[model samples]
Target: MNNLDLIVVGGGITGAGILREAVRNGFRTLLIEQKDFAWGTSSRSSKLVHGGLRYLKEGHFGLTRESVKERERLIREAPGLVEPLEFRLPVYERRKPGRWTMGLGLALYDLISWKWNHRYMPRNEFLQNVPQVDPRGLVGGFSFSDAQVDDARLVMRLIKDAEMNGGKALNYTRVNKLLRNSSGKIEGVVTEDVETGEIKPFHAPCVINATGVWAENLHPSPEKNKHIRPLRGSHLIFPWELIPITTTVSFFNAQDGRALFAIPWEGSVLVGTTDIDHGNSLTDEPRITQGEAEYLINSLNHTFPGLKLSLNQAVSSFAGVRPVVSEGNVSADKESRDHVIWKDKGLVTVTGGKLTTFRVLAYDTLKACLDMLPHCNLDAISEPVFESRRSITLSHTVSETVLRSLWGRYGKETLTLLNESDEQDLETIPGTRTLWAEIKYAAKYEKIRHLDDLLLRRVRIGLLLSKGGKDYVGRIRSLCENVLPWDNERWELELKTYFMLWDSCYSPDAFQNFSR
Candidate 1:
């Protein structure tokens, strides 16, 4: 640790990406997270790896182009995890953006990626594709391609890949203090294990703060009035049976004219993303407020009047605070999604970027650190973010879909997971795309520190199931009993803690109870 070339804080996508790139360049790097990996905004995103189509409307064509390029690269390199998703934006008779205007935007969007994947669908064809859409004022729609991913798994993939390439990562390890030299220059960090309360210090020539919303805590903005604006974006997950749609349906909310989406993710329909000032402490787990829930529900009802979606129909809800850097003059959605880097001698704080451009953020952050680590190679950014794809063959007959998923999430570790798993573990979870084996695999290998880590971020069953997968807790415990180091009493305590967390943070009913 004393000879480390770099240290990365935060364990989100940005931190993980930086660690991976640093390791690829043969730098001795270590990444430490205050909580579980992706315990913050990374796990709670809208689950899109999309080129910010709306950015084009805001005249941020450069951001859109970078995101589009990254989106295409991820689709090519990580197939199963970052799979292609079709999006359909239905046009209304009185909507602000008419057909011609939307067509122009889509044309530019396609031109950026050099892919002609967008087309104007007539009302009849649009209805045939999305019958659940409200047809009252429907004037056809625009179809385009984007991508989706298991957000937490993507973070885990980057971290695991980095570890495989000779980097180290620690979860639930908090950096209590930044160490500095005589000239008031940062030199290293003092870390404390959250669970054990054990304190230790590590030295590095260059340290990076990629803590997203918490970046300001480690390194404040040097500019006047420029600060990290914590904007909370919340989402509701419903069973696909309730609001079945093959492609994502993006529409504008009549109440505020803000664009929202109802996307098909995993085995459920994810409707989200109300952006507003958080106005809450960063330490507390974010949850959907009652007003935000109603706002999203109203948008869904307006778009799919036939479905009549409600909060009660939703299986779960989640909220993540965006680390948007703002000047306190613009609306929440009007803020830029671009990342910024501030260097204070040996410390480089990189914050405020979209998930789609993480690699770009990583390269930029490392380039900022080049002055401190003269041995680091900046050209390594051109290399692939992940290891080359390996051909995985199993003795048992597993579906191509499942194998692809395992490869995308686990990479080279897929064969080991399949080899070490019991045959029964190969079965998919009753209500999720997650395999039962994944629970065991994560418990044994994914550095899981708690039951919530296993269910919530690792496999996402907590977000996909009703009552936060309460019914399957027994089976989950059985699968992970030997793998996790929890005894009976510890198991009971974990269950109590996990259910309490789920009830307060992840349950859709939590909003109703909170409103009371």
Candidate 2:
């Protein structure tokens, strides 16, 4: 711990992946996050692990191929986190891309994946599989394979894996400035513990600035802002019954030619993701604009004419800014998803890229620094280790359904989660598949410094539940009362802070009559 070969700035998935890769490559590493891990775009993605079917249209074949390989690898290596999801892309009579065109794209997708599982479904079979789609102009659909994931959980698991491989992680630690040698080459960082007003210095031969949308803050350049554009993507969550569908429904927005999806996840349906340029400060939490919500709702209603969906039906919502590499004066959505890595003043800054290809991005980041860091050994890169315990364990009785969910999420730590729980903890939270044990385990082992860190990120009850988990606030408080060492006054304050964030950042009401 005293001497380090590399230091990672940011606790996001990108930083976590770098730390994991660095440790596996025999480097002594440390990772520091200004907030909690996955507290930014990593936690707020559309939660898909796919080959970017849309990217194929833009001639991003290499990106799509890499993503397909990684998506398949994650489904195999992290079975508990990355899960296969079926997608139905319904093509209407007047749709931009006709049925045949869409079918050809699906074929190419399947070909690149080499799994050959996609199919073109006729009207009858399509309606049978997805009864919710409007039959008005439905001209059949294309079914393809993809994957869904708990983005935040995957990031936390990577951090856990990095720690298991001898990498050090410190949450609630802010890197105020980069440290430099006499020649002004970056060497380390000066960090401040957010919990307390204490400053400390750490030294390392190399430092990585994997701060996503906030990357420019670490090593600012005259053209840094020109290189990276923050594109905001928002999603609205609804009760599964409201928009019941066993498979994801993909369609283009009638008003604009943007892609949108209604995905089934975590016992609920998530309809999301509008990509638009965000001109707001990176420090502020991204809130879904009312316009964005209305746009998604309109897309859903147009696709399922009978549904008559509205903003009121949305249980909650979320927004994240994607760090997209700018591609001239094009639209935000047209910006390249490919990540860029470069060294400036000895600081390796990594920005852009999709969530599904984080591992490749991490390896690329390290490879970018190989010349500058001759002492680092890339040959030592080892295969990921999946089974290992990082938390304490206890005894309990739980159902097989709940057991499998825990195993998929916790991996080797599922035993610890079960041991940490009793019968009461095994009960599922009302309206959610999540159990009370998840909240307890997160509070105990996930380094939850804030209430939202536990409810929103660690367990996602805040985003999945109606009213952002407000109804179960008392129950959750009771469950984590002993685990988190906070006084009654502190608990009240944390509750107030969490609710403010939930109402403003995780619900549609936050955008009612509000402007950016």
Candidate 3:
């Protein structure tokens, strides 16, 4: 049995954030995840770190304000990882939210962040920027500032920071059940290793159930009438050349008038996200349905009629279940994105929030669990999310762009990763922003128990490249063989497993099979 001050029961952004905050506040924290880090909704997000501009139109001023503030903070703190992304919202004739309504909303969005970064672009100018957009209506558009991030990298960075501050984390570890004291209060947890099937007990007075969609399984919601509603948001990733827009294009779907986006990320154009109730079992990996895929494809064609994009052009598809607390009265899209914190004796459950406001969620969770932690410093909640380090000094051969990216992802470990890499390792993998050195570093140090964790989360080539980067398996294996302790038999098994998993969950063809 191991004793600790706090144990977080999830490895997504919310749980990672809690672990980092708790460790900084002088708590001996440990985070346990059933699967790979950010394998759930965190990694499958639309990859926007914005103020939820649509929320403002929905009258969620508080969420929009907090998200906007956090967006600015992340862009300032993590420059390369959370860079400013300009969004172009094309106006169409007889649209629900016309030009002035969007202009006022953008004005308020700018006002919340104290930056005047939005302007109305004429139709010709907008066409000059996004030539593929549908021009039948021939209306102008509004350009505004937001931010984007590597969702998995952000979660990994938070976990890495927590570990650096003496906190511990275990991936591929499942907390089977909560251990309770004689008085029926939560005391510890019984965890099972997903790979080895070894069960272990860890004692902690303060246990936080930041498990996102799976939170209710650990601790039921305090509100009997309200429950965690699993809403699926699916996305499609296409080759950049197919939908080559320099900036993010935000538009509304003509079929349902729902907000949709076409974002350029990591050398690919990401289009998605259909918001609908997820009816699949939570234990299985969420996949994009054929109906959802066709809906997204139709939206793309509606927005960019010139491109005439088809579903077959998408290289990959992914779906994630958002833990939305719902009263079961409104539609899935209308459900609130605000987080809820429930405390039952020693156990505190936190769920339902956006990726952009993870820090706020962390702070709020800590505040909720403050009474359980007597040694915690309240002031620590207001501290910077990341540690401020001295400027990195590296060889002149490393470009400023690569250095910034490495710093944002690895922080203090950037120098070590660079020092350990060969000259050729510094070059990025073809068709992706990830460097070959990242594979070696993650395999050796990032607790990669499986090949999917490396290709999917650590570097994200799995989603960026076709066939989940299957073509580069030989190169990746050569790069990581020395670092990873896998024999030939194990390597073959891992490759088979990874490719099977990718086909079932990530490939666009999966949707076709699923519909059949």
Highest lDDT model number: 1
Of candidate 3, the 10-residue stretch with the lowest lDDT total is 387-396
- Candidate 3 Cα outliers beyond 4 Å, as residue runs: 514-516
lDDT by residue (tens digit), candidate 2, 199-247: 9999987899999999987876346455778899999999888898999
> What TM-score would you give candidate 3 relative to the actual structure?
0.98
How accurate locally, in lDDT, is each candidate?
Answer: 0.91, 0.85, 0.90
True-vs-predicted CA distance for residue 251, candidate 3, Å: 0.9
lDDT of 1 at 515: 53
Model 3, residue 164: displacement in angstroms? 1.0
Question: Could you give candidate 1's per-residue lDDT for residues 1-516 as a string of tens digits?
Answer: 658999999999999999998888888999999999999899999989988888888888888999999999999888888999999999989787899999999999999988999999999999999999988888999999999989999999999999998999999999989999999888899999998999999999889999999999998898878999999999999999998899999999997889899999889999989999999999888888888989989999988998877888999999999999998888888898999999998999999998999999999999899888857567787677566667767766798899888889999899888988889999988878899989998999999989899889999999999988999888999999888888999999999998888888888867665555
Clashing pairs in 2: 80-408, 394-419, 395-419
Better of 1 and 3 by TM-score: 1
Query: Residues 1-516, candidate 3, lDDT per residue (tens digit)?
Result: 266888899999999999888888888899999999998899999999988887886789999889988998898888778999988889988877898888898899899888999999999999998889888886999889799999999999999998988999999999999999889888889999998999999988889999999999998898989899999999999999999899999988887889999999988899988999999899999999888988999889988888888877889988999999998889888888999999998999999999999999999999888788866576776576665555766653788888888888999898889988898989888877889999999999999989989988998898889999888889999999899999999999999998888888899867655555
